[model samples]
Target: MKKIEYGMDFVARNLGIFKCPVCGRSFEKIVHKSVSCDQGHLFDFSKKGTLYFLKHGVKSDYNDETMWQARRNVLQAGLFQPIVDEISSFLSENRSLRIIDAGCGEGSTLKYFENKRESNKDIYVGFDISKRAINLATQGEGSAFFCIADLAQLPFAANSFDAIIDMFSPSAYGEFERILKKGGILFKVIPNENYLIELRHMLYEKNDNHYSYSNAEVLSLFKQHYPQARVKRINYEFTLKETSFEDLLYMTPLHWGAAETKIDDALATGLAKITVDVLLLMVEND
Candidate 1:
């Protein structure tokens, strides 16, 4: 077995009361016998030593295990290391933090952070609509609480997390605002226009008009929703090995449209360099 890092140990130590189910207030300690808020909403800690605060309806298809395993493989290969590096740099100032990764697919990004950082004082929580993803994450060395919950309606209470990560996933502005602590940072990463161009080229046999919203458009959207937040953009390029190329195609949303012949052509063609444009928005919870 591989050794688990200190970050994993940190998450396990701060297990309870860090997140309030009703209001999303993150507490340094659990003072009460039962976890409750002033609103009288109570949540119980599970036998597995995790919490399930989400009570509303949730989606089901994401609970499949196979999809999560594939996602984990793609991420673990370091194909998307630039994005991970940016996430780490963004949170460097934060020590002993309570971090949550919303729509945390296979938990690779969260695990990467846990393994890279030195502190065992921070708690990392990964929540997704998929129970399979959560199960796989829990099995790993990193300490993360997984939940099958909706992004639009998070199970956590307001202002609970010191930081929240939204990477290539759906966003719930209200829920984000509710769960992030005051002055908390929310890092939202979206793909740039050139992301996965090789796969796009192969699938279409020609470049179709790639659909990408401008940075200005993203800025406008964030301004409208989170006026007080500060935002930053990080863009870079990475060389891809044959396996990385295949992983890129397989893991992206573009895989559905790729023809078998096109995939074969890409495999035969060998190595390629792809540009990665990611927008990292560091928003403050106002």
Candidate 2:
């Protein structure tokens, strides 16, 4: 009898959805460290236990080692606990469902959820376009599976996942619809208009227009896909720890165009806390 690899058992048991990224065909079998389709397109699983599905033109701002480390640090500091709590409360009570996080950078959010519901015996998978993020995401493994793939062109068979959690990440509605099982849920988190008013006022010229985040387009898409979707805002404020202020500055894309002098000035000001606001849009596939 052939020996089963450590993670292959899990995939063979519950993840038949692991499709070929190159040919968009379902994999027939796993052999000698690689999953293959009939066309011989091999998706190799690394020794570290992660599968890379993005083959070409892979680019991401979160690709750098330092950037992923900084994100992990910020998440470990409990910066998004409240947000997580709010998001988790909205999850369905069904425990056997297969859940995957789209664009799961560093995999912190999925890990947090898995840890919270460890006794549920559910399957948790996190996928990202950035190999660096997926590499760091493999450190923890309590029912968590990590993969490198683009959300836009997911490497999974149709009707694969029971739920897709898309927090602060891009969405491929077409792909999501194709991969989600009937009656599956899509939990999307989007930044609120006043998500970071204080930081913006500090680093750049004040423009209410810029700070106002309209979800008209997002909602339109949501309705197009899941006509019976719900949207709600989760807003709160927490005093910033001076220690994490620098991490916060660098971790966010808001400051990408800001001058160094302004960022330093914002840090020097010692302003404490900022509003944390986001919208949770729940859509279902019927």
Candidate 3:
């Protein structure tokens, strides 16, 4: 089947969850090739089978295909498998769920989670500001829906989702609080100091300030938002092949500001073992 037809079927199944980003009116039904709200705001499904929900086009640093492909490679290699396992086990307790992956880039992690669990009662929907990211996400094998939308201006109704997954992405806490159903959990993942330490050390060997990093402020801000939230610290290392190491370098933003020579040196040296230290914050909406 064509992507639009498949996308239309998914949309029709989950129609009640969506709201117009412009008018904040709930969508009633699919109108031919598009979904419309009471205000007549129309959103068309792209030929790629994903919906475009952004009111205006936005530029993103992650709009490149190479970066997303590298990310896909890293994920498929099972680097973040532990984290995915933890989340899937926690989610398995629920009989059914409606999950929206906030800032879900390329949709690999969301797809991974859906695959890990036993229940087919979950509805997986992912949205990213980068159109390229969503496009890449839709190409993958999964029943999860993908769309182009901003995190801050989420195109959904209040109290809509059972859980919101924020993986290494900026938090729109207020928007998150607005959309989550009461008691719904928010699973947030943030990097610890050792995350990609080898890359950081290589990229900034001489710069002490750049070599050292901290997540104090990030943790503090998350606590401020969810005073009663629980946190899980996960620390581990994964061995990567030479090609996977190259993919890691390109996939991460660590080298975005580093010198070309530094990147080349790191690539030449090659990273065999990499750390995956990170924090998992879980909070329930009251």
Q: In model 3, which runs have C-alpha deviations exceeding 4 angstroms?
A: none
Best by TM-score: 3
C-alpha lDDT of candidate 2 relative to the true structure: 0.77
Model 2: CA > 4 A from native: 1-5, 207-212
- Please give, for residues 111-222, the per-residue lDDT of candidate 3 as tens digits: 8877876365688889988888888898888888889887888888899998899889999999999999997999999999899898899988655577878999999999
Please, what is the TM-score per model? Answer: 0.75, 0.89, 0.96
lDDT of 3 at 49: 78
**Displacement of the residue 45 alpha carbon in candidate 1, Å:** 8.7
lDDT of each: 0.66, 0.77, 0.87
Instruction: Give the candidate order by descending lDDT.
Output: 3, 2, 1
Q: Quick one: best lDDT, which candidate?
A: 3
Model 2 clash pairs are: 240-273
Off by over 4 Å in 1: 1-67, 92-94, 205-219, 241-243
Q: Quick one: ranking by TM-score, best first?
A: 3, 2, 1
